[model samples]
Target: DAMVIQNPRYQVTQFGKPVTLSCSQTLNHNVMYWYQQKSSQAPKLLFHYYDKDFNNEADTPDNFQSRRPNTSFCFLDIRSPGLGDAAMYLCATSRDVTAQYNEQFFGPGTRLTVL
Candidate 1:
């Protein structure tokens, strides 16, 4: 009965090391998103794939990247796990039916810890 799943709810990585967080949804939605959220801060949109149309937020750092090879799956790859990259990585999904307004359903999130 898992609608959305994220592997390794908590992850630890050394500084400058690469880490990848995964997310999958059973909802079969067409739109998938990745967001980064720090303590007491709003979740910032990193990027999203709207049925293969990749849309990235202008302020997203170059060290952060994401990929959606197919529906129901998405991955966030951190090129370098710096101290600043330690945060909660949240994955969300929404239907592509109505572009005007669509609410996103979030996963449990993977908390990345950089040492």
Candidate 2:
């Protein structure tokens, strides 16, 4: 089945370092999302870009940024990582969340560790 794919499943970075997580989709879905999960807590939606339109969550940190160059690729950039930034970064996709059947497919995620 088609799904979302994230690179560098395990990432270790020093404090204050910059990191970038890559995400790609084989399903060619219209909506792409980025999320952060700390420990056992529920994943928090950071932002998502639909086609060329980008929408960010009201509470998302200013340190985070995203870019979707085309339909198949997206990237999450963390300008400066702090100790609290360590978590599992997830990438997901769906046709449209507002639609009746908004089935989102998630990638395995990239585990980021701040040293």
Candidate 3:
């Protein structure tokens, strides 16, 4: 199954607090990605780990960070979530080798609410 899974489909985070979101995949893919999306807008790539290589999008904020210690799991850390950070956090996975032609699989997403 080429499925990417994210836990806690909904999360309520406080302003200026830290939150971590998790993702796991059964696709055995070599790359995992984190994205931030808001109100039906296009998902913005935050970062991705292609095996041990970490690629961060050029415009990603410093407040966002990520880690992938193993092949199947990855974590997204948002430090001091602001009101602007109140959005859906999407976890995605793709095969590193076929990335040019293959599309990434996305999770159901964790909807973060900052208050």
All candidates' lDDT scores? 0.90, 0.94, 0.90
Better of 1 and 2 by lDDT: 2
The parts of candidate 2 lying over 4 Å away from their true place are none
- Candidate 2, residue 78: the lDDT equals 96
Top model by TM-score, which number?
A: 2
lDDT of 1 by residue, 8-36 (tens): 79999999999999999998888899989
Worst 10 residues of 2 by lDDT: 95-104
At residue 115, candidate 1 shows an lDDT of 98
Error of 2 at 41 (Å): 1.0
- Write candidate 3's Cα lDDT for 3-115 as tens digits: 88999899998999899999999998888989889999999888889897899999999999898989999999998899999999999888874749357889999999999
Stretches of candidate 3 above 4 Å error?
97-101
Question: Highest lDDT among the candidates is held by which one?
Answer: 2
Note the clash tally of each candidate: 0, 0, 0
